[model samples]
Target: MSITLVLVVVMAVLYAAGVYQMLERSLTRILIGFLLVGNATNILILLMAGRSGLAPFVTDDGRSYEQIAEEMADPLPQALILTAIVITFGVSAFLLAMIYRRWRLANADQVENDETDASVREDAAGISAQTTADDRALDVLLESSDEGTAAKHGESAMTDDRKEDR
Candidate 1:
């Protein structure tokens, strides 16, 4: 019946669900799992904060600062929660990246499923292969029979002036 008891139960349920979802293959479910776990962690921190009290900020109610300090809520727990939130954000990014990479590794195939994928990959490979250091297409195009005297730094002197042989 107590609020803390109810919160503890809720936290337990959240943690259980989050961990279960984390075991699943779907990225979206994993993301949900991360979020749930993060929230449950926040709740755990809150429970560890002890009994709640008035806000820490001082008010002009004719009370001395010394007398009010005793009832003020502990800022340390709040600060710890903020730190946890930042850590969760950073951890979530890495976790998502790891899950995505794993999914890609497991799902990706060397065998192209369709003609479009095959053609695109083949064309890309061919284009990149030509631009390698051994080919030296630019050097050949820029070379002049006159030797030492090279072309000036202008568009007309560049390889664009002539058709590139593939």
Candidate 2:
């Protein structure tokens, strides 16, 4: 097969895989999907550039400037690809940081569904604002009670109680 055809096929595969991966709940898979998509886009830009030719550098050859221009490869696509690479790297890094933060906060790699999202949708569809406010207050109250219980018992009390049972 021709190189262009090969690249086109690869691009199509990457796009399909990327879309599938992006739909997953795992943040790592989403990041990988983003990378695949970026690489596929870069390949698409390269394919649009046509066949490779002489570099755009001006030489002291006797050939006219117009002839040299005709023989030279387009530089814009390469430059665009380079910019896209940098942007992809930056975005990937940001996503990685967010994943790490999420793992630290929730102790899980997969993104959990937010209960608040459902509640917000319900509220938008006519649920009263007072109900949402009461839910938030209940959450805060439960959290404070849990923290108070932990503080009142302390680590030493739990360890001693366990030792007695053993």
> Backbone collision count in every prediction?
0, 0
Best by lDDT: 2
RMSD (CA, Å), candidate 2 to true, equals 20.8
Off by over 4 Å in 1: 59-62, 99-166
| Model 1 C-alpha lDDT per residue in residues 1-166, reported as the tens digit of each score | 9999999999999999999987775776777898899999999999999989989999999999988998999999999999999999998898778767866887731222588988999999988887785468666654652233433433344354454752
Instruction: Itemize residue pairs with steric clashes in candidate 2.
Output: none
Model 1: lDDT to the true structure: 0.81
| True-vs-predicted CA distance for residue 101, candidate 1, Å | 4.7
